[model samples]
Target: METTFKNKVALVTGGASGIGRATALAFAKKGAKVAVVDWMENDEMVNLIKELGSEAIFIKCDVSKIDDVKAMVAQIIAAFGRLDYAFNNAGIEGASAATQDCSEENWDKTIGVNLKGVWLCMKYEIPEILKQGKGAIVNCASVAGMIGFAGLPAYVASKHGIVGLTKTTALECATQGIRVNVVCPGVIQTPMIDRLTGKTKEGIERFKGFEPIGRFGLPEEIANAVVWMCSDEASFVTGHVMAVDGGFTAQ
Candidate 1:
C-alpha cells in the first residue's frame, strides 16, 4: 500500500479475462509480480504478463469454494512470497428473472459466487495481507450494488452485500494497516456485457443507453481504478465505495 515500495506482489481473481486480465496486466506493468486467479485457466494472461516484463502465474480457482480459495492464496504466497494488494474481482451474473420468479437454484449459485466468494477471498486473503504489515484490497461491486435493478434479484442482492462487507472489513482492518474498499463499476465493455447483450447491436445499444456517458466503458477504465485503489495513491481511501460509472450513478 505504500506509495514507494519494491518487490510488491498482487493477486487478481477472475484474472483470465475482462477487467481481471486488465488489472493483472496493470500491476505487472508497474513491476509487481501478479497471480492471476480464475475458475478456468488461461495461460495467455500469464504469458502476457511475462511479456510485460514482470512475473505472473495462473491459478485455476473457483473462489466460491473455500478449499479452492484457501489453496489459491497459499499458492500465491508460495510463488510470490508475499501479497501487498488484492483485487477480488471474480463474479457472475446469475440468470435474469424477476424477484418473484427467481429460482432457488439461481439464487443459491448467484449468492454463492458473487457474495460468498468475495467473503471467502477476503477471509483467506486478509490474514496473508496482514502478515505483510501493510496492504490494500479492492473488491468488485457494481452499479447494481448502489441501486435496484429489475429481473436480477440475486445479482443485485449479492452486489449490495459486497458493498456492506467491504465497509465492515475496512473498519476492521483500518487500524491494522490494511485498507479495504470496493469498486462499483459502471457499464463496462467486457465479455460479461457481451453475454448480457447477446452480442447484438440492439442489445448493446440498449445497455449502452443505461450509461449516462452515452457509451460503454472499457475494461481498462475499470482496471485503472482498481489499480489506483490498491496503490499508495489511494492510501487515504478506505471503506469507500467508488462508482466509476461515468456519471451513471450521478443521475
Candidate 2:
C-alpha cells in the first residue's frame, strides 16, 4: 500500500527530542517531508530523517515569540513549497508549586511557551494550511489539561488553555477544510519527564503508579496517536481532545 503522507510536508515544533522527535520520525517514515522545529539544534534528527528516505530540515524557533513563529513558517514554506501537516509540540513543564506559592515568573514562562506558543504557531500555520485548501494541525496538551493536578498550577493552566484553543480553532477552520485537534498525553517517557522525575528508578515507579496502566507511556506511543490524527483516517475528527494517556484519565 502507498504511504499516507507521501510527498506531503509536515512541521513539528520541539522536534529535537521526546514526543516531538518520535513524531517527526514517524511522519518521515510515512513519506512526509519533515521540518523539525525547536529552540535547540537537531542535526541528529535531520540525519535520521534522511536515513528514513525522506527529506528533512531543522528550523530553530522559540514558538512563544511571534517573530520566531512567523519566520519558522516562512522557512518551512520556502523549503517545502507547501505545508500539509503541523504538530505544535514545543512546551515546558514549569516549576512545581501550589497556585498561591507559584511565582509570577514561572507562571509567565509556562503560559508563554505552552499556551501562547501554540497560538502563535497556529496564527501563522493556519493561513499556510488554508493555502493548501486542506490540512491538519495537532497541538500537544497534557492529561493535566483534562483534570486538575496539584503542585503544577502554571503548567495545568497553560494546558487547559491549549484545549480551549484547539477547540476554538477547529470550529473556525472546519468549514474551510482545515482540521485542528489537541492530544493529551499522560506521563510519557521523555527527556522532560526525566527532568521532572530525575530519571531515578524510584521516581519512575512513582509516576508509573499514577496511571492505571502500571507504567509510563513511551514517546513512540504518543507519536502513533499524533500521526494518526494528521492522517486521512482522522479526516472526520476535529476539535477533539484525544488522550493518549494509557488509562490515566480513565480513572
Candidate 3:
C-alpha cells in the first residue's frame, strides 16, 4: 500500500539499541523522519541510519531526567516542526533482588528510569502532540507488569506503574485525538537480557521458559507491533496493554 507513516515525524527514546533501535529504523523505512534518543553512543547504529538513506538523527538523552526529556522534546519540535508519533522506550533492567533485599539506591534508580522516565517523556510529549491535534505514543512495559515475579520487585513495580499510567493517559486524551498504549515484551533478545544471563545457551533457555513460545523475542518483532499500534491501522485502538510476550501472559 501507501507505505504507512510516510512523511510522519517520530521520536524514539532508548533508540540506540534493542526494540527502540529497531522501531527507529522501521519508522524511517516507512518514510518517517526519525529522532533517535538514548544516553549511550552507538556509532554503528548512527552509521546504519545514515546508510539507510532515511532521515534519522541521534540525540543523546537520559530519560530519567525530566529536564532532559523536556529539552529533547523541544529540540524535536524545533527541528521537525511537529511530533506525530513517539515511542517512550527508554528504561532500565533494574537489579534483580527480592523485595526484602532490594537496596534503596537500586529501587530509586529502577523507578526513576523505568517509571518516572516514561512519565517524564509523556509529560513533555503530550503537550506537543496536543498542539498537533493528533499523535500516537507507545511505552515499553514488560510481562512482569501484568503479574508478580520473585526477585524482581523494583522492575515489576515500575512496569506495572507504566501500565496504569498508559491507561489513565489514554482516557484523558481519547477525546483530544491522542492515542497512548503500552507494549509488554517477554524475554527479548537484547543486551539487557544478555547482561542478566551471560548470553550463554543455558542462560538464553532459562529466560525462554517464562514464555509459552519456548523462545526469546526479537527486537524487530517488538518493533513491528509498536509500529502497528502507532499507525492509523490501529486507529480504533487506545489505552491497550498489548503483550508481545509470546503468550507469556496468556497462560
Candidate 4:
C-alpha cells in the first residue's frame, strides 16, 4: 500500500461506520495515525487500525455541540501531538417531508448535526492544522447538496450549506497552508441510506434506481475519494466540490 501519508495524523468524524470508518481505515493503511470521532464506540475499528500497523484512538463526540467539538480536538492533540488532516463527516438525515409539512424539530436536528457540526469541527480543527504548518480538510456533503431532492428539504439545505461553507473557508485559508474541500456523495451503501430507505428490498431497489450506475455506491468508493483529497496528490486542489455520485448529479 502507498505510505504517502506516513507519519501524518488524520481525524475522521462519524468514524464508527460507513464512509467515515472506511476513510479512517484508509488513512491507517497509508501509515497515518488516526483519530476516529463519533457518538458511538468503535473498538473494532480502532483495533483494526492497530492491526494495520498504525495507531488509532476512538473519540466519542456529538459533533453538533461546541464543547464536544472543542474537547474532541483537544483530545486528539493530546493523543497524537498534531493534526494534519480532517474529515468532518458526522451528519444526520432528518425526517423526510415536504417543506410545508416538515417538523421544526427535524429541521433543527438535521441542520445542527450536518451543517453546524461541520462548522464546529472546522472551527477547532483548522487551528490545530495551522499549528502543524499545513493540512487538508474534507467535509462530507451529498448529491442532495447540489440538486433538489423532494421530501428532503432539511438534508438538502444542510448539504448545500456545507458546500458554501467549505468554499468560503477554503478561500480564507488558501494562503494559510490549509486546504478545505467537500465531497458530494451519491446514493452510498451505508446504514444511513438503509435506514432512510426502510431496509426493504423494494426500498433498496428504488434507491438504486436513482443512481445511473444501477447500484448503490460503496462506502469504500467515497473513502477513496476522501483519502485522495487529503493526500499530496490533490495539493493544488482546494475549494472544490467533487461529486462521487455515479452520475447522479450529471443527469
Q: Number of clashing pairs, model 2?
A: 0
lDDT for each residue of candidate 3 in 132-183, tens digit (9 for 90 to 100):
8898999999998898889989999999999999999999999999999999
CA lDDT of every candidate: 0.92, 0.94, 0.89, 0.94
Give each model's clash number.
Answer: 0, 0, 0, 0
Could you give candidate 1's per-residue lDDT for residues 143-213 as a string of tens digits? 99999999999999999999999999999999999999999998998999999999999999999888888
Clashing pairs in 4: none
Give candidate 1's TM-score.
0.97
Query: What TM-score does prediction 3 earn?
Result: 0.96
User: In model 3, which residue pairs have backbone atoms overlapping below 3 Å?
Assistant: none
Q: Name the regions of candidate 4 deviating beyond 4 angstroms.
A: 1-3
Candidate 3 segments exceeding 4 Å error: 1-3
For residue 242, give model 1's deviation from the true position in Å. 0.5
> What TM-score quantifies how close candidate 4 is to the native fold?
0.98
lDDT measured at residue 141 in model 4 versus the true structure, 0 to 100: 96
Q: What lDDT score goes with residue 187 in model 3? A: 87
Q: Model 1, stretches more than 4 Å misplaced?
A: 1-5
TM-score for all models, in order of appearance = 0.97, 0.98, 0.96, 0.98
Pick out the ten consecutive residues of candidate 1 with the lowest summed lDDT.
Answer: 1-10
